[model samples]
Target: MWFSVAIRVGLAVLVNQKRYQEWTHDKLKRFLENGIMPNLYYAIDFTLDEAVLDVILIQGVVQCPKTMELYTGPTYIPNNVREMTLPGSPSGRARPIMLITTVMRYHLPSDLDWFHQPLTHYDYRKQRATSLAVAHPS
Candidate 1:
């Protein structure tokens, strides 16, 4: 499933509304200044079936002291983040990097609304699909 891919690729999902707002706002400013496309921030509605986690994703290259002693390329630094275990994963299965709840509407950021507006005139009952593969971790 696409969810498995998200786990493997080191993408993060921010469940906290306040933290998400602060983090996205800062990233947006930097992205505009650099002329790089802004990362997608999806607003998911879900029920928390278990405990909440303290997940944090840092920006820029990260250096490992252990790897420095080994034969590693200068550009080959740690960039992937896999924090927290999934709530109900089987004991022996490969633990997922992140936990995700059941998603309802995959909403877009109002900050980027000017780029493409959502159709408000359409009926709400219609089935609409969004892709998680396009979402960015940073």
Candidate 2:
């Protein structure tokens, strides 16, 4: 039973992905009239742990314009990022915005390092600037 349910859910995702890929601008017009179809990005409710899935879903993902394939994490977005089909997706902004939520992000280090050292405002700025310069040069 569980296997059947999994297969069905997987099939639904496959179908939805396909529909999104093949949808044309004219398809949306049917919604205005007496359309007999549903071709929108419906919220998915998969059989997964809510907490873990919540962590994953909170980050915006990119979809290929032609394929409608989903790619999670901005790590995949490169200089040659494929254009997205969905308007206002902001795949470009996903990197900087979602960066804070990434696994690499550090939060309140317990050990007191140079950053935690007592210093004047000028010293702090100088340190920060030096660090930034070293991290990314002009």
Q: Identify the candidate with maximal lDDT.
A: 2
Give lDDT per model, in order. Answer: 0.28, 0.29
TM-scores for all candidates?
0.18, 0.19
lDDT, candidate 1, 27-117, per-residue tens: 6333222221112122111122222222222222222333332211111111222221122222322221222222232332455332475
Model 1 / residue 12 / CA error / Å? 6.2
How many Å off is the CA of 56 in candidate 1?
Answer: 7.2
| lDDT computed for candidate 2 | 0.29
Question: Best by TM-score, which number?
Answer: 2
For model 2, what is the alpha-carbon lDDT of residue 2? 22
Q: For candidate 2, give the lDDT of residue 98.
A: 17
Identify the runs in model 1 with alpha carbons over 4 angstroms from their true place: 1-12, 25-53, 56-91, 98-138
Check candidate 1 and list the clashing pairs: none
